[model samples]
Target: MPATHATEHSITVAAPPAVVYGLIADVAGWPAVFGPTVHVDVLEEADPERGGEQLLRIWATANGRVRAWTSRRVLDPAARTVLFRQTVPAAPVASMGGEWRVESTGDGTSRVVLLHDYRAVDDDPAAEELIARAVDRNSHAELAALKEAAEQGELRDELHFVFSDSETVAGDAGDVYAFLDRADLWPQRLPHVSRLDLTEDEPGVQHMDMDTRSPDGSVHNTTSIRVCFADRGLIVYKQLKVPVAMSGHTGRWEIEPLGDGTVRVTSWHTVTLDPEGVRTALGAEATPAEARALVRKALGTNSSTTLRHARRFAEEARARA
Candidate 1:
């Protein structure tokens, strides 16, 4: 028999156990809920009440490379726990399994516990510890998020809208593109933008942080990745980091020449909020319009500021040309 090693983590959620269990059972939604660190591909999902199974392929990236594994879920709704076992498709250095349990606390809340165990194929303690550490860190963050979702209700609302604005600027597309690519210019040009940082991992791909002052004078931070397409006069940015209520958000920008002496720029976005999750967190009185306004305000300000800066930068470049 393989040696059993375990690690346990618990979270108290304000939602009922059934609600939390259902969310847990919807394993396919994990990627959308957890963001980029984990990717889950569901091969199969069956009735949880019938004691059926789910087959999933999980891929995790670390140090900029991907590691994949396969696992099977044996669910028991009566017990409010799902047991998972690793299968043959896992990597040579990894074997993983875990149990997800949801229990009602009888005080209008749920207690969730996630227990996982993994042993290296070579039985290396150090390797196991490294994997354990990563898993623990990720699990803690994920569970806490679940608790927040369950207790606070849906973070996102149903109705969503995409708004965009742009302006033409006089300059070489390349010169203008280079300026937009560097996030470090934000604080100097946009008063609403407090701080900006850029991290480049490769040519044409960069991650950016934009810290802005909200209308209420509160600080709001958004992190996104910008991909430049000089050939198309386009620079697209998708939100990879945002406030909780603004989860599942994506945006893009397109810049095109007007065949005259100016570049046409456009920006747009999509956002989704979990209704139940928001209610649990913000109370039943939460309004979707309020959430939508928050996103609109952030995007509107950023887009307008970017356009103004682009125009000024383009004018300067044209003069120097």
Candidate 2:
């Protein structure tokens, strides 16, 4: 009997070959960058010259569920290529393997080819087309996101004053508390955040450099200290250094654990105005009421976007666990 298979897709990204390679090469970090759709757990690291390869356990969630697979990496650093073979353990009906090749195209552009070879374990003719189409769609989406992140440099400096309200996932306080304590996960999940360096000043107090992006494509670098009140189920972050537009800004995140493994999270941010810019941006003639309304609108939009990403992260973490 002939082995069943699926199709592959490719896309070119406008970035240096190294950058493109680095992004994909950092396979263990995929879950944070790729959102909740894909999870890559690293079983081994890469050592290119010695013919060492990375191994990853892959899980993909779609239509409210997850499917798991194991892949063995075969990487060629000199050629800038990484290939993987899917090992299907239980689900014999489907299999997938792919290669990522990066080549330099002059003028700081790189051509990326993502090719996949897939086979259906069982002889299910009808499922082949469906699986192929789904794989194509997913591959395209993944490339598009990678392109954006690469070209945009992953860190964004788009800042805004905002308020957010979140109810704990599954209504569990302990889970919520544990999740919030892991601030390291934020940089992985939020695209606008490039790096979050943290230092402990004292017990329960941590200082951090939050390198984030702003709405107008500017980078906002803020240094803040977070005081954790684990017993009270609260964490407060007070900004020490902020951009001109966000001077005197302070933000706080509060998690009130409700029974049944859920918590209510609320975030409040206050900004001190720069008279010159605010007057010019909002118009010197605009009243305080108008300014407040405008600020609220911007904040609301930011909050909504943040919440959507946060929810996806929380849901995926729960599912994976």
Candidate 3:
């Protein structure tokens, strides 16, 4: 039998058990709430005798490297617990399982405990050391962020928002996807892009460092990681470096065929504003509402520009063919 190591980390959150549980159960929102999480997708969900079972694909930063894995989870809302096991663990990890339990401490508070059990392939000491360190670091970061987000309560809504911009293309979805996937050419094709460096060390995964020129002629530098799904006509990205007034940003580009020889190409964005950054960027008395409006306008303008260019590119390509 393979020897397994177990670890636990716990934090006290000044929020109700149900509230904390809701944050954990809503896996789709982890990227915005947690520092290490980049993206999560629910592949399947079903009600089972044990509770609710779900298959999840999660992309996260582990020990400074971006990794992807599939996990099977059982969620018990009444018990305020979630049990998860990695069905496809990333490298250096042979097997991994974990549980998130939220217990009421009374007085409108909860104790959140994160537990992990894992084993390294071939019982290699080096692999074991790496996995243990990553697990500890990520668990601590996740718990701290969870506490901060949960404690924000109503304030979270003001600081976070989702928005999108789109255009219709009378061309193929593949052409639209190609235009978005080829970020390396943006500096030449897109007027707002001044310089961009893109690297794809792994297929379908891209790392980008770009300098974008704002309408005021001020250039802002940003770095991002993007995962592309050509067959699905989708590309999802998370910005590692954000603007001064933003705390987090994640977005996706989708191309959907309308079945009429045309496609709807859309850009979706989710952003969380930073209060201190907002004050610095705007003014000392700047409110969250003002920051929200500024972000919406800036991102929407850029997205709309990109969508228009993509539509033109795709249509022109079709015309030439």
Candidate 4:
């Protein structure tokens, strides 16, 4: 038997076992709670019988770089425990699996334990050490975030929305991601964009500054960061500088091939609205519905325009060929 690299870490959270378990049980929401998790895609749901497998693809930060992998998990809420095994382990990790156990101390506090067992792909100590450090760092951050979220009585509800707009293109889906990937050309390709700058300080991580002209000819300057998942055809982003009527914004762009020679491109947004900003931007008389309408229109028009252009590009290419 090969030697296994194992790690176990726990923290006492000032919350009931159930509260702590609730946060850990829903792995899909990990990105909002864990700092290192940029996005999570739940590929499969667990089967109730025979302890079926629940699969997930997680994009997370390891050693300051984004690393993505798939994991399979089984949950037993009755025992307040969950077991997980990474189906596709990241580099240097031959295999990895762990369990999360939450136990009540009967003193209004609960102990949350995170355990991991793994083996290196090769017996190289230095590579193994790097993997170990990443595991420890991520584990510690997750536990701390879990404690804070559970004790606070909510987990990421403040994020506030999820809205999406999609368009069907009679062209290749793979081509759509390119339109978004080449954002530096947007200013010339799209009229609504006046100025833009993009930088991938590290591959797949993008930082951009853009000035967009809204319908009323008003320009909004925004700074944003995006994590691109090229293989999966998805890009997730958060706006560092937002419009006057929003406190924060996050979004994703996804391209899906319908498999019938057509593709669907979607733009999704989740925003935290500042009611105060509404009054400032739209005057004190604007109602909530009006404010929301304005926000949707302002953002949708720009996104849809981009999607349309992508469609034209794809169709035009096919026509030329």
Model 4 over residues 188-304: C-alpha lDDT tens digits?
A: 999899999998857888878999987789888998777888898899876767888876677899999898888899999876565678789899987656767778887888888
What lDDT does model 3 reach?
Answer: 0.92
**Backbone clashes per model, in order?**
17, 20, 0, 0
TM-score (all chains, Cα) for each model? 0.56, 0.49, 0.96, 0.69
Task: Sort by lDDT, best first.
Answer: 3, 4, 1, 2
* lDDT leader: 3
- Which prediction has the highest TM-score against the true structure? 3
Q: Evaluate residue 144 in candidate 2 and report its C-alpha lDDT on the 0 to 100 scale.
A: 78
RMSD of 2: 15.1
Question: What local lDDT score does residue 260 receive in model 3, on the 0 to 100 scale?
Answer: 97
Instruction: Look at candidate 3 and give me any clashing residue pairs.
Output: none
What is the C-alpha lDDT profile of model 2 across 231-313, one tens digit per residue? Answer: 87677555656454333455556766566565566666654444445567667775444555666555455545555565555
Per-residue lDDT of candidate 1, residues 1-321 (tens digit): 655468999988989888888778878655445543344657888786776798987654433334556889988888899999878444434577889999989998988999988777677777666677676777887797777556655432244356778777776666667667666777887778899898865576667887888767998888866666677666655566666665566555667778887777766665556555456556688887766776677668867877778778878978986
What C-alpha lDDT values do all the predictions have?
0.71, 0.62, 0.92, 0.82
Error of 2 at 187 (Å): 27
lDDT of residue 137 for candidate 2 = 69
